[model samples]
Target: MPTDIAFYTNPMSRGQIARWMLEEVGQPYDMTILDYDGTMKAADYLAINPMGKVPAIVHKGKVVTEAAAICAYLADAFPDAGLAPPVDQRADYYRWLFFAAGPVEAAVSNKSLGLTVPEGRERSMGYGSYDQTVTTLEKAVSGGQWICGDQFTAADVYVGSQVDWGLTFGTIDSRPAFEAYAARLRERPAYKRQKELDGALIAQMQKSS
Candidate 1:
């Protein structure tokens, strides 16, 4: 049986990324949009996720938190989507996924905040430096049209979201490779549909405000 999913979110947050993943998987979900007055921190939601974060999902009576985790879970649950690779490809899948979540996120966050690694600790930094991370990502995307290869997998959803958000906020440089990669991702029907839905929701929210 397919599990019923409850997606707790705030559209303005990273929850948008999870929304995109859900659309990619073509899963039906019930959404509860949280407001800024600490509503997400309420006792009930906190029971679902103590961290009071958006992008949490309750499926089959089990709660899954964190954006990346939710994306990965949905891919597994909906095998028909083929967002994930086979067991033999699991190693590469986990590698690139975590690489996007950890180092890529850290670099983007730090860059947005104007933070820099200490001069002596540069070598010890997980992401090395923003420029180095961007260069590494450029090479990865430059190797093929997508992150993993010619195929578009869930890895692209995760990593592509990072690259898309980074470019949108100017946190990451817009090299030609990155630009081309983002263009290809945007051309996907799933991505376009999700963006349109999100845009309408945003407009409605603004009108109500």
Candidate 2:
């Protein structure tokens, strides 16, 4: 398989999470920045990712989409990064990864869009309600330093992104556990690298536009 990886993203999007994962893996890769109105919706880009979304990666002649999936894939692909948990610890790793990607994402996003899951339908919806989602989520992750326990894994990339974004936008509650967790996430070398690089890219884009 070809080792070269191509990352498709815009500096201001969730692609930052995938960029952090790539940095943690410490591999050289190419990045393609797409503007919302320009190349993002073009036919060629759509062929690589039907959704035309930011944060997609092409490696080993395979395309990987979705932030959490990309994070987990890079972690396992580059085991030297030590970002993937051992088999025994994978339960929590996978649990929180999918939880953040699915329920947490839906709850937070829907809430942001001003859509409610409705009062009686909490039991029916996968995410329950926004309040219940964030509350239960805090217990599972915020209380602990990392989702899979002490050693941070790819799970942190996904979970931390949600937490950091939520706290920044005030979409989620500013609980003590959350503040402490976001603070720790911002301290990571890889995360900082992503912030610096993406920040500069965002600035450059803004100036050029």
Candidate 3:
């Protein structure tokens, strides 16, 4: 039987984020592993995502791309998963989710590539300064529960991934708040399962190459 969801990804990419969300949703899905220099950029895939990126999904014929968007979409699509805050209670959910997608992602990528914002030109960048972005992120997750209080919404899946990856790669500061938040996220069964699935795929790809 085919699932309504068709996930296209590479285990080594941001696809891991979507995979975690899928695991949390507990839905059956079919996965297609695309190679970076091959089918990922092929015409069929480019038709699905012109950006030629991994981490794209087709749910009931509708295509969704970008890791953050995928998490949010899955949460909404699978309401039974309880991965999204109620409409009236989504202020923090939307805020922090997009915060990680926008400011945190931009800050980390720019810093990794050694692209510093010129002094006083921080206003031009969406994230302002990298230090400011990191500080703001620290405050958001320091609350000790989830991104949206007691509920473990999709916002955590997206925002937490940024913190988790940042901590592992040293792209973000290793503050107690960030560390604590990631520790809690690690405790999720879905998170652990996502890692195991992707880790095995990565190992296989490496062995074959």
The estimated TM-scores of all candidates read 0.94, 0.96, 0.99
Give all candidate RMSDs, comma-separated: 1.9, 1.8, 0.6
Ranking by TM-score: 3, 2, 1
- Of the two candidates 2 and 3, the one with more favorable TM-score, higher being better, is 3
User: Per-residue lDDT tens digits of candidate 3, residues 72-125?
Assistant: 999999999999988999999999999999999999999999999999999999
Ranking by lDDT: 3, 2, 1
Judging by lDDT, tell me the better candidate of 1 and 3: 3
Of 1 and 3, the candidate ranking higher by TM-score: 3
Error of 2 at 167 (Å): 0.6
> Best by TM-score, which number?
3
Model 1 TM-score is 0.94
lDDT of 1 by residue, 1-209 (tens): 45498888887888888888988988788888987667888998889988887889888798888888988988898899989878786766787788888888998899899899987787888999888888887776787877667778888888889888888888889889999999999998889987887788888889999
Task: For model 2, give the RMSD to the true fold.
Answer: 1.8
